[model samples]
Target: MKTVEKIERKLPVLKTRKRVAAYARVSMESERMQHSLSAQVSYYSALIQKNPEWEYAGVFADYGISGTVTKKRDEFNRMLAECEAGNIDIILTKSIQRFARNTVDLLNTVRHLKELGIEVRFEKENINSLSGDGELMLSILASFAQEESRSISENVRWATIKRFKQGIPNGKFTIFGYEWQDDKLVIVPDEAEIIRWMYAEYMKGASRIEIGRALMERGIYTRQGKPWVDSNVKVILTNITYTGNMLFQKEYCEDPITKHRRKNYGEMPQYFVEDTHEAIIPMDEWQAVQAEFKRRRDLGPFGNKSLKLSAFSTKITCGCCGKHYRHSGKRNTAGEVYYVWTCQTKSQKGASACHSKNIPEKMLQNATAEVLGLDEFDEDAFSQQIEEVIVIGDDTLTFRFYDGHEVTTKWQSTAKTDWWTDERRKLWGERHKRKDTNPNKHLFYEFTGFIKCGCCGANYRCQSGKRKDGTPTRSWYCTGPKDQCHNPGIRDETMKRLVTDVLGLDEFDEAAMDAQIENATILDHTVTFHFRDGHTESRDFLDKRHGTPWTEERREKARESMKAAWTDERREAMSERIKKIRSEKKWPNP
Candidate 1:
C-alpha cells in the first residue's frame, strides 16, 4: 500500500447581507393620512438601513391609494417587481391590511413571495410570512379588513342616498354651460348663448350633427376643449338643468370593489328639484323642444334632418320578416338612377335569411296613387293619410290608413320594359361588345367560356398580365362570386400542358383540342376534360408559376421587395382600393 497524506485547502468566505424593502400606503388623500404615510416611509427607511444584517433596497410608498386592489398602487407594484427580480429577501409592511385588504389578493401575494424564498414581516401583527402559521393569521385578519371596508362603503352609500332624498346633489358636477359658484349652479354668458343657439337650431329642424358641424366651423368646442359632437349637442338640448331644474342620481356606483358606475334606469329612485338654478330657457320652450323630439322619433330614421326624406322611406314594411324596408338605388345602363325598396334583412343578410322581393320605387308610387284615388302620387296627401304599406306575398300590397281603413291592391312589376328603354338597350349592347385589346389574347381566348368551375358551375374568365421580365402571362379563373367558389386560377401554360398530356399529343394543338374535347372543368387540384365521345379524363395540374427558376433565394428576395414596397401610404391606398371595390360590388360594409 502507498503512503497516504492529508491535504488541507484554505479559501476565503464572503458574508452576504439580506436585501430588505419596505412598502407603505394611505387609503385617503387627507392631510393627516399624507403625514402618516410620510412617517411610515421614513421609519421603514431608517429601520432597514440601521440593521447590520440588512442591505437597504429603498422604501416604496403609495400616497392616497387603496390597498384592496394592488393594480392601482404604483409603488406596491414596483416593490413586487423588485422582489421578483431577486433584489429583495424580506419585505417590511405596516400590517396585513396595509399589504392588502382583499383576502384572496393578500393570501395569493404571500404564497407567491413564500415560494420565491422571500419573507414578509408585518410589524403591526408581529408575524413573519415565511413561518408555517403566518398564512392562517393573515387569512383571518385579511377577512376582517375586507369586511371593515365593505361596512364603510355601505355607510357612505347610505349617507349619499339620504342627501339625494333631501334634493341635495352629492357633489358639484361639470356641465358645459354652467359652473359651480359657492355651491350653486351659475350659467356662463357665452356658453349659455351657445346653448340657446343649439335649442333654436333644433327647433328650426336642424339636426344635431349639423349644429355640431357649425360649432366646429366657428372654432367653438366643448368644455373639455375638444371638437363638438352630435352627443354633445344632444346633451345640451335635453338637459333639464339648463331650465333651472336638477335631477339627482341619474347614475350611481353599483359596487365598491369594481367601482362601476351604471345608469340608474329605474334601478334606484331619482330626485328632481325645480328652481334649483337660474333658467337659461323658459320651461315652456323646453317642453316644446321635447315634443318636437318625440315627433321626429316617431317618424323613424328618415324623420331626422340628416337623411333625405322619401315618400315611402319608413312607410314600407316587409310582411314576411316584419322588418322595415330600406331604400336602395343603382344606375341603369342609360345612366339613369333607379330606386327600389328592399327588406332590411334581405339587404343585410342576403336572400337566404329572408325571401322578400325588391319593390320598384315607381311601382310603389303607382300603387299608392291608385289606392288614394289620385291620378299621380302626392307626397303631402300620402304622408297625412297613409300609415304604412305592408308587402304581402309576391305581388300584393296592403295599405293601412290612419283612419282605420285598409286597401289591398295587386301589383305587377314591369321592370323589364321600364328599365330597358331603346337607348338603354343600345348602351347595354355597346358595353357588352368584345372590348379585349390584349395582343396575346389568342393564346387563351379559346378556353374562355369553355372552362367551367367545378365548385360553382360558373364560366371561367381569362385574365392577362405582364411578368417582371416583360413576358406576357395569361390565367383562367372562375367568374363566380368568391364567397361561393374558391377554385384556384390555372396558368395558360399549365392548361395547355394538361390538355396535351390528356390527349397524348407532342404539343398543344388548338384545333385538335377543340375537335376532341367539348369542355373542361377546373377543380381545386385536378382538371376534368370532357371528350366529344361522352367520356372524361382527369389530370393533375401544377401551378407553373411556383415551379423552377423561382428558387428559395429568389422567393426570399421577392418577399423582401414586397415588404419594402408596402409602406404606410401604400397600405392606406390598398385599404381605399378595397373599400371602393366592395362598394362597387354592393357588398355589405364589414
Candidate 2:
C-alpha cells in the first residue's frame, strides 16, 4: 500500500463546461438609457463569450422595461424558459435591483434556477446561488432592493410635494389656455378666449354636453386633436387652473406594487397654489361657477326645470329633517301633467326618514305669491324679502323673512289640474323636441363653446359618415394638420353621454347648462375640462371595435387561418421581419 501511494501522481481534473447566459435591463427610454442599455448588453455578451470554462448562451436584454415584475420583461422571461429547458447551466446578471425590485420575484426565480441545478451569479452583490448561505444572503439583499425601490418612489413623491409647496412648477404641465414655457404656464390668447367663452356659455346656462357639441361644430378639437364632449365642457367649467391657481396631489398612488392611483379625497395631503399665473377666468366668476355647480347638484331629483319665473321654484324646504322638498311630476284623470313637492327623504328613501305631507306646486306658488305680495312668483322679490320657507309638518310651513320675522301658515293641497293647457303641453313638447333635433343636443348639459386640440390649438369640427347599418353617424374631426396631429374624431353622442354621466344630472335644463362650464381640452381618448368653478373633470372615449375580444377557440381559428394563408416563401419572408418587431413589445403584450 505504501509503495502504490508513492507511485501515485497528481493529474489535472477535467471541468464540465457551463452553458452561460447573461441578462441586462434598463428602465428608462431616454437616449442616455439606450446607450447605457447597449453598453450593458455588450459588456455581458463579451464577458460570457470570453469565458474559457463556459459555453456562450445568447445574451438576454430588456430595454426601457421595469425589473419589478417578470411580466413585462420579455427577454428575461425567454432566458428563464431556456434555463427551464436545461439549455443554461449558469446565468449572470448585474444586481438584485437590476434583476428584480421585488423580493418575492427574485427569491422565486433564484430558487427555481437552483432546483434545476443552475447557478445565478449576481455581479454587483458578488453572490452565487449554489452556496449554503447564498439564499439567506439573497433574501436579505432582495429585501433591501425592494426597500430601496420604495424609498426612491417615496423620495420622488416627496420632491413633487415639496415643489408644490414652493409653488414651483416641477415640470412642463399645461392646460388648454396655457402652455409650459420655461416651466411657467403662459396663456395662449386664442385659447384663453375659448376658456372665457366656455365659462360665459356655462354661466349663460349651457350644459356640458351641449357645450361639447357646440365646440365640435366650431371646429375646436382637443389637445390630441379629438372632438369635444359634454364631459370636456364640464371639466373646463370646473377646473381651478384657469383661475391662475394650481391644486397639487388631487390623486395619489395607493401602493408601490400595483401603482394604483386613487382620488385624493383626504387620503393624502393636497396643495393649493393660488395666483400661480395670469388667470383666464376671473376668481369671482370661477366662484360663481362653483356656486352654480353646487346649485346644479342641489337640483338632485327635479333634474332640469324650465326657466319660468315662479314662486314655487326652489322655495320649499323640510324644517323637520332639513331637506329640500323635491318637485315630482304627477298625472291627473284628464291626462294632464301637474307637479307637487314632497320631502326628498320621504320621496327617495321612503317615509321612514321624513313623515311629511306632499304640497301641491300650485298651492305653494299661491302661498308664496301671497306672502311676497305679488300676483306671480317674483324670484327677485322673494329673494330680497323672504329668506327660506321651513316645513315643520306636512301642512305646516314657517316663512322666515330676512327681517327676522317668522310667519307660520297651514297649507292645504288644492287641485291645479286645470293649469295644464294644450299651450302648456306644446311648451313641454317643444323642450323635448329641441333636445332631439339638435345633433349638438346629444348631451343633456347642452352648454356651448370650448374644447380644442392641445397640440395645434385647432378647433374640432363635426364630421358625418354612414355606419354599416346604413345609418348616419356624427364624429368630431380636428382642423389641425393631419400629418402633425394624429387625432381621430370622437363620436358626438358618446362624448355627450359621458359628460352627462359626470355631471350627475337628469335631462331638463336646456338653458341652465351654459352657465357653469369653462372649457375642454382633448388628448388621446381623454377630454380634460377646466371649469369656471375651479374644478376639473375627465372623460374618456374608446372606439367601439366591431368584433369582441378573441376567445381561446377564436384564437385557434385565427392561427389556423394564418397557417392556411402562409406559404413556405411567405413564412420565410415573415421570419425575416427582423427582431426589431419582436423587441418592440408593447400592448397586446404577453
Candidate 3:
C-alpha cells in the first residue's frame, strides 16, 4: 500500500466540446452577393472543422432571404433552434448585417442564445455575445447594420420608382392574341386568325354564345388553352388591345403595410401606348360590337329567353282564374295527346290548391278563331279577322311601368277587351276568395263576353284542370273557389276545332293562309286566295271585311256600315237620312 501511494501515474485528458454552427443570409441572388454568401459558408465551415481540439458541427445558408430581421431568415432561425436544444454551443456568422440588420432582432436573439449557454460571434465586428462586455459592443455594431439596411432599402425604392416613371412595365403578365418574344409583343398567326374571326362574326350579328359555340366546336382554345366562354368573348370584344393600343397601370398595389389596392379610375394617371402591338380587331368593328352588345343588354330578359316553342301550349289561358294553362304533348296509349293549363298556386299549397279547370290546347285556339270569325265558310272574313286580330294583339301586348314594376300589359281576350294585370294574377289566390255563386260568370264576361258558367252563374270561358295522368287539362270553369265548383273549362282542342269551323275551313290546315299568300301576287294591299283543294276566291277593296289601304273615306264608310248593321232598320233609316249622300257617283276610281 505504501509503495502504490508513492508511485504517480500520468493520465491522458479528453476534451468534451459542444458542436458549433454558422448561419448566413443574403437578401437577393445577385451574382456578387451570391458568391460572397457561398464564400462565407465555406470559410466558417473550415474554420470550425480545422481546430484539433474541437469538432465541426454544420453550416446553414439561406439565399434570397432578407437579413433585416432574424424572424424571416430560415437558416438563422434553424441554427437558433438547434442552439436552444443544447446541440450547438456556438454560432459564427460573417458580420452583424449578415446575421441580422435590425438592432432589435439582433439584441433579442443574442440575449436568448446567452440564456441557452450558446454564444454568437460576429467575424467582422470581432465580438462575441458570450463575452462579458459583448452586449455594449453588440448594440453599437447592430445600430450601424440597421442604418446600412435602411440605406439599401431606400436605394432600391428609388431605382424601382425611376424605372416605373421611365415607362417600363414590370412583371410578366401574358397577353392573348400576342406572344411575348424578347420582351416584345409578336402576333401569333393562329391566335390572330381566331381573334379576327371573333370580331368579324360579332359585327355581322352573331351572338356571343353563338360565336363561343362555333369556336368550341372547332376545338379552338383560348391563349390560356381554356374552353371559350361568352364572358371571354365579351372581354375580347371590349379590349382596346385588340385595336392596337396598350394600357398600363389599370390596377395598383398599395404599400404592403397598408394592404390596399385602390382602383385607378380616372383620378390616377394612366399611360397609353398606341400602336405598340399589331391589331387583331379593327377599331370600327369593335365599337360597333360594343354598341350592339349594349343594345342587347338593354333588351333585358326578353331577348335572351328561350325560343324553343311556338304553339297553343304557349297561348292557352285559364278563363276563370286568369292563369295561363300549361301544356303536355305526350301521346297516351290511345295515341291522343293533350295540352292543359294548371293552377301553380294549388300545386305548392297541397290541400289549399285551386280547383282550376284544364282544357286542351286545341280548344283555346278554336275559340280564338271562332271569336275572330275565321272559318272556311267565311273565307273573306277569316283573313280579314286574322289580320285585324294580329294588329290588335301586337298593339296591346306592350310593356308599361306600374308601381316600380315593368308589366307586360296585354288584352286577355280580343272579343271581350279584358286586360290582364300581372300583379293581380300573382296575388290572386293570396288575397281573394273564389266566388262560388257564379263560377263561370266571370269566364264569359272576362274572356269571351258571351259564354257563361251554367252551374254557378260564373262566366264560362277558360279554366285549367289536372287529369289523372298528372297532365294539365284546360277548359272553361266555374268562377267558384276550389271548395265550391268543379266546372272545368272547355277542351282547348274543341275550341280550336270550332273556331276553325267558324272560319269555314273544312279541316285544320295551318298552311292554308301561307299557301294562298305564296300563290298570290300582291302590289300593295291586294291579295288573292287559292286553296290547295282547288278552290279559288278573290275579294275587292269594297268586299274586304277589314278596311285595307286605310283611307278617310273608307273608314267613314266602314263606320256607316257598322252603324247600319248594329242598329235596327228604323234607326238605320234615320242614320241614312242624316247622312249627306247615300250613293255618290262622284267617287274616284282606283
Candidate 4:
C-alpha cells in the first residue's frame, strides 16, 4: 500500500518563543552607577526584543541595593514571582554577583528556578543555571563574591578604627543640638539654647519628666519635630557631647549579614574626644548633674523622679521576705481611702510567696512616734532618728537607728474601727436594710452583717437557691477563699434559731435581736454572740440541711425525669465524651 501511495505529507511546526527577563543592580547610590543601571536595563530590553527566539519579559533592576540579601530587592523579587508563575523561561543577569552575593541564597534561588523549568544565564561568566555544572560554578563564584564583600566590610571597619584612634569622627551624625557643617559638628543656636536650659533645670533639681512636660507645654520639639519625652530629656541631660566632647563607638554593628547594632559595654574600644564640638552645657555643670544622678540612684525607689516620696518610702523593710515595703492605697468598706505598706513580694506575687501582713500608714506613724517617745508623729524627727523600720510580724515593728540603737514596739492596727465613723455606720445600716420584696427578710436577713466567720475573720456571705423540689433554700458560708478557709456552711434556719435561743426570744424578732446583739462569730461547732451590753454567750452550732426531704415518691419522680433526659442521642454523646476523657486520662476501658 505504501508503494502504491508513494506520496509524502508534511506538517508545519510552530516555533515557540522563550520568555526572557533580565536583572541588574548596583550596590551603591551614585549618579554614575544610576546611569550604568539605566544602560543595563536598556541593553537587556533591546537584546531580548531583537532576538527572534525570545519574547520580551520586563527587565528588573534594583538600584543602590545590596545583592547579599534578596528580600530588599523589589524588582528582583517580582522577576522571581514571574518565573514561578511560568511566565519567564530564562533570566539574564550581568553576573552571578549581581544576582546574589550570598552563596546559599544564590544556590537556593537557582535550584528553585531550575525546578520550575526556568534558566538563569549570566552574561559576564557565560554560565547557564540550567546546565549540569551550573550549581557547582555558582557556589564557587558566589563564595568568592561573599568573601569579597566581607573583605571590603573589614577594610572599612579597620579604616574607621584608625580614624577613631586619631580622634576623628567616622561620619557627621544628626545630633539634637548640633548640625554638620564642613564635616564638623556645628552648634544650632536655637537647639543649643534648649539644651542649656535643660541642663540648668536638671541642676536646679527639676526632674527629667518635669523638664519634658515644660518643653511640651511650650510647644518645643526635638530636631526631628517630635514631642519631647522623658527619655529624650534624659538624653540631653546626660549626654557629655553637649559639653564640647564626643564619645565614639558607644555602639557597634555586631553582624554584617543582620546589621544588628549592640551597645558597647566594654565589648569594644571606645574613644572619648574632648573639644570635638562647641559646648552647649558647661563641663562643670554636667559633672554636677551626673553626681546628682548617682545620689538619686543610691536613694533607690524613693528617688524615682515621677513618684512623690513619702517619709516611709524605702525606709520600711519586710523582715520575713527581706524585700522593701511598697506603698499602696486601699478603700475600706466605708469608702474611706487609706494607705498601707505591703511587702513587695506579697504585693506582686501574692501571699503564698510572702505571708507578711500590711501595716497601715497611720499605724506605722503611731509606732514610730511611740518608739521615738514623741507626743505626735514628726516626719523630720523620724527621718533624723530612724534608719529603717523592720516589720517583724503582724503587729510588731523593729526600728533601727542611725546611732546603732534599736527599739522594738508592739502596735495594733485600729484601721478597721477608725474607718467606721458614726455617719459611716448609719450609712452602712441604711445600705444593708432589708428590701420589702423578700417575705423572710426579717428572719434570716438581719443575721447577714452580724454573722462573721472566726476562721478567716470574714463576714459570712448569704447564698440563696432553689432545691430539687423547687423550694427556696438559704445558707451562709465564709466569704474567704474556699481552698484556704475550710469553714463549714451553716443553714439560714439554723443561724436564725441559734440567734433566737441566744437572745432568749420566744420567736425571732429582728428589732430585739439588733437591740441586744452587737455581733456574732461562728467557730467550729460553736456560735459565740457578743451582746451590746458587753456580755458574750456561746452556743453549739447545729449543722442542719433545710429542704424538702427526699421521699420515695420524689425519688421515683427524679428517676422518671432522668429517664426522659437520657435519650439515645444524649446517651451516645455522653458515651463519646466519657471515652474521650478516659483516653486523655490514659485509663483502661471498664
Local accuracy by lDDT, each model: 0.88, 0.78, 0.61, 0.86
Flag clash pairs in model 1: none
Model 4, CA-based lDDT: 0.86
- Give the alpha carbon lDDT tens digit for every residue of 1-590 in model 4: 35565568888987999999999999899999999999999999999999999999899999999887888999999999888788999899999889998888899999999989999999988999888898888888889988887787788889999999999988877789888889788889988888888888887878788888899999998878898887888788888888898888988978665557898999999999989878888899999999988987898756666776788888899999899898987875546678989999999999999999999898888888888898989999998889999998887889999999898889888987887779877777645543222334566466667778889987787898998889998888888898888777888888889888987888888788877887888888788999989999998975764566799999999999999999999999999999999999999999
The CA-based lDDT of model 3 is what?
0.61
What TM-score does structure 1 among the candidates reach? 0.55
The parts of candidate 3 lying over 4 Å away from their true place are 1-10, 68-86, 101-115, 130-150, 171-173, 190-243, 247-270, 281-590
lDDT of the structure predicted as candidate 2: 0.78
After TM-score superposition, the amount by which residue 496's alpha carbon in candidate 1 deviates from its true location, in angstroms, is 41
Candidate 3, 204-300: lDDT as tens digits: 7777788888999999888778988878987788777788777766766443222246767876566776776678777787788788778868954
**Residue 271 of model 1, lDDT score:** 88
Q: What is the C-alpha RMSD of each candidate to the true structure, in Å?
A: 22.4, 29.3, 29.0, 16.8
lDDT of 1 at 24: 90
Q: Rank the candidates by TM-score, best first.
A: 1, 4, 2, 3
Mind giving the per-residue lDDT tens digits that candidate 2 earns over 236-279?
Answer: 88888899898888778887755678988897988888888889
Give lDDT: candidate 4, residue 50: 97
